[model samples]
Target: MEQPFRVCIFCIRTFIHRVLEPPDDVKKLFQDYSQNGTMSMDGLLKFLSKVQGQNNAKEDDAEVIFNSLKHLNIFPRKGLNLEAFYRYLLGDLNTPLSPRVHQDMTAPLAHYFMYTGHNSYLTGNQFSSKSSVRPIKKALQNGVRVIELDLWPARNIKSVVLHGGNNDVEVRHGGTLTTSVKLLKCLRAIKEFAFQVSEYPVVITFEDHLTADLQEKVAKMVTKTFGGMLYRPEIDGLEKLSPESLKKKILISTKPPREYLETQNSNSPHKSEKTSEEQGG
Candidate 1:
């Protein structure tokens, strides 16, 4: 049931009592919860009041907010949403209008990837088929939620798992037309191989060279062959896709500059960007 005027009045009275005389333990609990990203607006208000009363000497509200946020697991990992918090602190709550409480900062776990033509591990030794599965296995073992793959398919018929050109195969096979191999074998190999290492679901992200049906086919294959491990669809021009499409299990493999992200958050209707092969597949 909706809260009526009497309910609002009761809530207002409760809030007044809370602000005027909050308990000592409330501050500690508020600090704990705020650090964990579990703090509510009521908790924050109580905590701020406690801090103000304790210090009679004024403190920077920004510092207090940052200290509270430092407790979250995402802090020092992903960039902080400072602007939204700043607005909240400065905005007039009793005015005709107010900004949102806090812009959503929740994000899925992500892993960085860089593709190489040759299967050389970071140790500079050629990877055996046994060793070839090591990097992927490690990612799975560490509970990596996403795996980015780079592709350069001339025709959408075969999705080549490559970020850039492969000259090693050409040199070995000795022909101009004999370019990189285009087959599902490598992708299938990762799936079959990772299953041996971990049971947790893995989301495979693909970066293709602007093909039409390739994304659809890959999406089908991901659902059919790999138990829906695909995390991205139509790797290029993600800004063009509708909002609903962007919100599914799929994510566009684009990491724009911090400035771009801030600008988009402030002005643009879209949040994703056009990814370069340099950022990872």
Candidate 2:
């Protein structure tokens, strides 16, 4: 119930009105705090401070929360009841994710257990899945900070995602009969939705099977699509790069040519290692 006071020029009077709504166990708690079958601002303030851990909670803060959850048509008009409390707490207002970035973003990317999505482009089973941007968008929207894409040459066309013409490289699972999603299109989707939910860095790990030329083309496409949002490590080791320093940045990772060649040579019968330019000299 609310005791709203009113004074009309010379006349003065007061009126009382009511009403409210949370869950069963929570409902018991709410009932415990309420008075005279109505939840007033004081009860809510107590709940916020003690139960919800808003230790420094003030009446104003409680008012804000109550106003948001309180039923407009309820008797008190500005009061929260059992149902209102239950519904708001169970709704999006009570999302598990923190409203703002609270963790130590200054730590190295390795220090964080990022929400990673393996083969994020596939909509179904890996062997016979359709490659599309829907999954990519959903992942980004749901706060998947790391995405994996396997890049290969496009079927029948070198390129298709970029604006100029065909995207020479496409994304799919390697050595499997799976559909492909254009690299540029994927990049575009990443660019568009990467930070929609959180202002954190997104790492894209590539299972690259493209040749040197196609790799160059992909690099261009990525640069064009992401523009300034792409993280180009100005320094050497990624160990020094912190997540705080890479906010809103897109970091792409793939095996280097030297590493790829070394692995291939290790599997060969002759195992003849080619000399690098520096060693050749």
Per-residue accuracy of model 2 over 8-99 as CA lDDT, tens digit each: 77775767563332336887887888875667788888887788776888988767666665444443654676666665567665676656
Whole-structure CA lDDT of model 1: 0.39
| Total clashes in model 1, counting residue pairs 3 or more apart in sequence or in different chains | 0
Residue-by-residue lDDT tens digits, candidate 1, 104-165: 32322322232222321111233212223345445545545355554443432233345432
Among the numbered candidates, top lDDT falls to: 2
RMSD of 2: 11.3
- Per-residue error for 25 in candidate 1, Å, reads 43
Off by over 4 Å in 1: 1-145, 154-183, 228-281
- Supply candidate 1's per-residue lDDT for 248: 28
- Regions of model 2 farther than 4 Å from truth: 1-76, 86-102, 158-164, 257-281
The CA lDDT at 24 in model 1 is 51
